[model samples]
Target: MKILGIDPGLRVTGFGVIEKQGARLAYIASGTIRTPDGDLPQRLKSILSGVGEVIGTYRPDCAAIEKVFVNVNPQSTLLLGQARGAAICGLVQADLAVAEYTALQVKKAVVGHGKAHKQQVQDMVQRLLSLSGLPGTDAADALGVAICHAHSGDALKALQAFAPALGGKGLRMRGGRLVG
Candidate 1:
């Protein structure tokens, strides 16, 4: 399964693509969409267009995005949420199923701990994907989200949801087993 992971931000949105086969993950591509200094609307448009292009080019089977964490400043959190909204719109427009994961979840999946540092996440992502060099911070976060989703046992179900337009509706679990 091919998954595109997104780490959305106002100034720079990061993207990573990975293919999962059995228990292994292969890196396809990773990069950042750096928006120039501009107004809020322009930044959001850049995020939407940039993410849409990534989806079009990669043609991923599904997508997973990092959820916006509320910051100390409510304003910052709101802006981040807007950027996330634009990213999600891109995925929905492409008819791709999307999964959302918190930052702690992503870190725990990649680094085996919820509070791992940036360098730790970067190091783990490189090791897991067998990359020779460290991915930048934002790109590594995106890849971390992809890795989290891959380990999460949801890729097939996510793709299945797309065919039926189910999105998040089909899967539920109870008592350690799938319920829907």
Candidate 2:
């Protein structure tokens, strides 16, 4: 499966593409979508268009976005939310499934700790992807989002497989878990 991961930001949105085969994940491409400093609406348009172009080029099977966390500045958080919305819209327009992961979830998946430092997450992302050097911080973050989705997807499938044995649903899970 090919997955596109997005770390949405109004000023610089990062994106990474990864292809998963069997138990291995391979990096395809990664970069940041930067918008000029200007009106909010125009910046958002740029993000949407840039992300659309990426989707068209990669045609990924799915997209994983990092969910917004209201950090220090409310204004910045709102802008991030808008960027994330645009990113998701672009993916939907491309007929791709969208998945969201929290910042902590992404960190934990990549670095094995929810509160891991940014450097640690970046280092682990490079190691997991077997890259020679660390990707840009934003790109590494985007890749972490993708890795989180892949890990969560695998766990979900495993849980589904054992759901029936645990007296839950049959082969599929509803509301994120199986119920018999």
Q: Pick the TM-score winner.
A: 2
Model 1 Cα lDDT, one tens digit per residue, 26-140 = 9999999988797999888999999989988999999999999889999999999999999999999999999888999999999999999999999999999999999999999
lDDT, candidates in the order shown = 0.91, 0.89
Cα-lDDT of candidate 2: 0.89
Q: Could you tell me the lDDT of residue 72 within candidate 1? A: 100
* TM accuracy, model 2: 0.94
What TM-score would every model get versus the actual structure? Answer: 0.87, 0.94
Model 2: per-residue Cα lDDT over 1-180, one tens digit each: 999999999999999999988779999889999999999999999999999999888889999999999879998889899999988988898888888888999998999989998899889999999999889999999999988888888987877788778777656546644456
lDDT for 167 in candidate 2 is 75
Summed backbone clashes in each candidate are: 0, 3
Angstrom error at residue 35, model 2 = 0.6
